[model samples]
Target: MLTLLHTADWHLGAQLQGWPREAEHRKALRALVALAAERRVDAVIVAGDIFDSLNPSAEAQKLLYDTLKELRAALPAATIVLLAGNHDPAGRIEAPRALFDLVNVAGVGTIARKDGEIDAGVHLLPLRGAGGAIEAHLLAAPYPRAADLPILDGASEGSPVVRSVRALYAELIAAARARIGAAPLVVTGHLHVAGGLESEGAERRILVGGEHAVPSDVFPEDIAYVALGHLHRPQSVGRECVRYSGSLFPLSKTEIDYNHGVTIVAIEGAATTIEHVPLPRPTPCLRIPPRGGLARENVEAALAALGLGPATPADDKPFVHLTVAADGPIVGLDAEIDAIAEKFPIRLASLTVERPPRRETEAPAPAALRLSERQPVELFREAFALTHKSEPTSEHMTLFHAAAAEE
Candidate 1:
C-alpha cells in the first residue's frame, strides 16, 4: 500500500489589503509538518503556487526552505515532491534542486525538455513503503507551456495543445512504468482539468491561455491517482482517482470559508481511499456587514460580534473585507469606512465601495467642460461666446469652418 499526502497553492507572501500574510502561511506549513509526522504517510506532494510571486521576498524564501527542512526532519524516510504552479518562477524553484536531494525530496519548477523528451531521470522518483520497498512511482510534472512540450518531429498525430500535454504525461507515465511495470502510479501536476470547481473570486481565470483546461481523461484509466493543483476548490475531476487538494488558506474573500487543507490518499493494488484533513485557520477573515456593503455604523458592531475590536487581542486580529451596499449610492464614501476599520483590531484587506447604477448624465457647466469630445467648431463657438459675451456670427462661423477645412 502507498500512503500519500497531497497539498497545493501555498501562495506564500500573499497579502490581503496590503497586509502581509507571512505569519498565516508559516503557521499552515508548520501544521502540515506536524500532520505528516502524525499521519505517517510514505510520500508528500506539493502541487505548485509555492510562493505568491515569481520573485519572492527573502522572508518567504526562508520560510519555504525552513518549512521543507522541518518536514524532511519529521519524515526522513518519506519521499517529498514539490512541483511548480503558474505563479512560480521555474528557475527559482529549480535552483534549490540539489539542496533538496539530501533529504529525499524532489523539486521541479520548469518542464525543461532535451532531445524531444523530458529527462525523466530527474522528475520520476520511487515511492517507498515502510519495508523499504518500492510501492509506486511519482511523476513530478509541473506547469507546462507549449514550449515545454517535446517536439514530435514528423510524428503524424493530432496537434492540439491539450493533446501535446497529454502526450507529455504519457511519456512520463510510460517512463515510470518502465522502471516498475507493476506498481501503481501517482502523478503530481499543476494544471486545470476541464469541469473542475473553482473558487469564484480567489483563483485566476484560465491561468494557462487558449487550450488551458484539458479533459480529465488525459490520464489513462488504469492510473491509481492524479494529484493536481491550480484550482483552489478541492474536488475530483471525472473520476475519484484524479483530484485537487486545494490551497492552504483563504487567499481572498471568496475563499474565506474553504475547509483549506491537505488530502491523504491510500492506494493498494487497484483500490484507493481519499481523506481530507482540514488545516488550522490561524486567522479568520471577516466580511463587514456580513451580507451587505460596508456601513460606518455597522463596522464596530460587526467586529464586536465576531469577538474582535476591543475584545480581540492584537495577535488574533482578523482580516477585514469591507464593502458598500449594492443598492445605495455610496461609491465616494470609502474614506469614512476606512476610518472606521482603523479603529478596530483588524487587518484591513479591502474596502469595496458600491456605486449606484449608471444613469444618463447631463453635460457639465463651462468650468467642467472637457475638450476630448468637443469639435473645433464647437470649441470656437464656446470661446467666442465666452470672450464676446455672445454667440459667434454666421460669417465668423463660416470663416472658422473655412480655416478649419484648410488646416
Candidate 2:
C-alpha cells in the first residue's frame, strides 16, 4: 500500500498581522509533523508556501529547518517533498534543497528539475521545475510561468490573448500525457485548477477565461490522482483523483470557515481511497457593538457574550473590536474605557460614538459638557496621550494636540 500525506500552504512564520495567534501556528506545525509520523505514510507532500514572506526572519528560517529535520527524523523511510508556492521566492526555496536531501528529504521548487521514472514496483514519475519531459506513470508539474510554455502560432475562436494561452496550456498538458506513455499516472501541480474552493483574500480572481483555468480533463485517463496547490481552500477539481490539499493554517479571517487539514490518499494497486485529517481549532475573534444608552453595561454584556468574562492576565484573549454610542451622560466613561483596555486582551480598531439627533425640547449642553459626552474623540485623545508619553517629541506632541483639539 502506498499512502501519501498531502498538505499544502504551510505558510510558516506568518504573523496574524496585529492578532496574537502565533502560538496556534506553532502548534499546527508541530501537529503536522506528528501526523506524518503517526500515519506512517510513504511520503508527505507539502504543496507550497512554506514561508510567509520571501524575506523571512532568522527565527522563521530556523523554525522551518527544525520542523523539516523533525519530520525527516520521525519518518525516516518516507519521502518528504516540498514544493514552492507563489509566496515563496523560487531561488530561496531551492537553495536548501540539497542540504535537506542529505537527510532523505526531497525539495522541489521552481528551479529544481528533478524529473525521472522511479520503478518501485509501481512506475512513479517525478516532474519538478518549470516544464519537463516525463516518461513515467506519475507526473509532477511544478509552478510553470506563462512565458515558459511554447507560443501558439494561430488564434482559434475567442479573444486573441485568451485563445493563445489556452492553446499553449492544452499543448503543454498533451505533451505531458504523451511523455508519460501508457502508465497509470498522477499529475501534480501548483496552479489554480478548475472547481477549487476560494475564500476572501484566499485566491485572486482569475481573469474571465484565462489560462489559469486548467480544465479537469487535462490529466490523462490512466492517471489516478492529481494533487494540486496554490488555492488555500481544500477541494477537488470535478474529478475524484484531482484535488487541492489547501493550506495548513488559517492565514486570514476568510479562512475561518475552512477546516484546516491535509488529505491522505491510500493507493493499493489501481484503486485509491482519500481521507482528510483535520487540524486543531484555530484562535477565535469577536467584534462587539454596544447599544447607545447603556454603554458600560453593554460593554460588559459584549464581553460576557464572548465568554471572556472579566479579563485576567492569564486568560488568552480573543481579538476584540468594540463599537458604542456615547451621546448620553455616562459616569466614569474614561475610566471604564481604560479599565476594559487594561483588563482584556482587546485591540481597539475603531470606537464610533454616535450622537442622538437634535431635539427641540432638549437644551444644548455647555461646550465642556459636550466635550465630555464625545466618547470616540476622547478614546482617540487617550490613545494619543499614551502614544505621546513614550515618544515625547515636540513634533509628535503637536500633532497629537492638534488631533485632540479636533476631537
Candidate 3:
C-alpha cells in the first residue's frame, strides 16, 4: 500500500489587498506538518505555485526551507516532491538540488532533455516505502513552458501546444510503465485543464499561442491519480482520480468561500481512495451582510453587529469585504466608512457599491467590439460605464487619454 499527501498553490509570501499573509501561511504549514506526522503518509506531493511570485522575499524563502525541514523530520521514510508552476522561477527552485537530496526531497522545475530526447531520469521519481523498497512511481512534471514542449512538426489534430503537452506526458507515461510493472503510477500537472472552475481576479490566464486550457484527455485513463494545480477550487475533472488540491487558503475575495485543504490518497492493490483534510484558517474572511449589498443607511448598524471589540489583536482580526447599496455616487462615502471602520476590529480589504437598475427607456448595450475594431478611448468609456453604471466624465476621459498616450 502507498499513501500520499497532496497539496498545491501554497502561494507563500502572498498578500491580500495589501495585507500580509505570512502569519496565515505559517499557521497552515505548521498544521500540514502535524497532519503528515499524524497520518504517516508514504509520500508528500506539492503540485506547484509554492511562492506567490517568481521573485519572493527573503522571509518567504526562509519559510519554505523551514517548512521543508519540518516535513523531513516528520516523515523520515517518505519521499517529498516539489514541482514548479507558472508563478515560480523554474531554475531557482531546482538550484538547491544538492541540498534537497540530503533530505529525500525531489525538486522538478522544468522538463529536461538529453541529446534531443526527453530525459526520464530527471522527471521520473521513485517512491520508496518501508526498508527502502519502491512502492510506487511518480512522474514529476512541472508547468510545461512553451520551450519545454516538444516541437510537433505538421501536427494538425489539435492545438500545437495541447498536442505537445499530451506528447510529453505520453513519453513520460511510457517510461514510467516500463519500470513499474504493477506499481501504481501517479502524475502531477501545473496547468489549467478544461472544466475546472477558476477563482476570478486571482488566477492569471495562462495562454500559449492563444490556447489557454487543455482538455482532461491529456492524462491517460489507466493512471492511478493525477495531481493538478493552478486552480484555487478543489475539484475532480473528467474522472474521480484526476483532482486539484486547491490553495492553502483564500488568496482573494473571490476565493473566500473555498474549502482550502490538502488531499490524502491511499492506494492498495487495484483499489484507490482519496480524502480531503481541511486546514485551519487563523484569520477568517467575512463579508458584510453575508449575502447581498447592504443599504447605505444600515451600514453603521451592520458594522456594529460584527461584535468585534477594539481590543482584538491585529493578527486575529478577520478580513472584511463590504458591499453597500448605492443609488449613485455618494459624496463623503469613503470618509464616512473610514470613520465607522475605526471603531471595529476587522481589517477592511475591499468595498463595492451596488447601483440601482437602469431606466427602461435607456438603449441596450451595443454588441461587443473586437480588439481590432475598438479604440482605446472607446474601450475605456465602456469599462468605466460597466463598473460605475454611468458614462465616464470629461476629467476621466482626459486622464484615460493621457495614460494611453504615455503608453
Task: Give the Cα lDDT of each candidate.
Answer: 0.80, 0.61, 0.86
lDDT of 1 at 56: 88
lDDT: the better of candidates 2 and 3: 3
Once fitted onto the true fold, the runs of candidate 1 whose alpha carbons sit more than 4 angstroms away are 112-114, 151-159, 205-208, 294-296, 309-315, 326-328, 354-407
Global lDDT for candidate 2?
0.61
Best by TM-score: 3
List the candidates' TM-scores in order.
0.82, 0.68, 0.88
Candidates ranked by TM-score? 3, 1, 2
Per-residue lDDT of 371 in model 2: 56
Candidates in descending lDDT order:
3, 1, 2
lDDT at residue 306 of model 3 (Cα atoms): 80
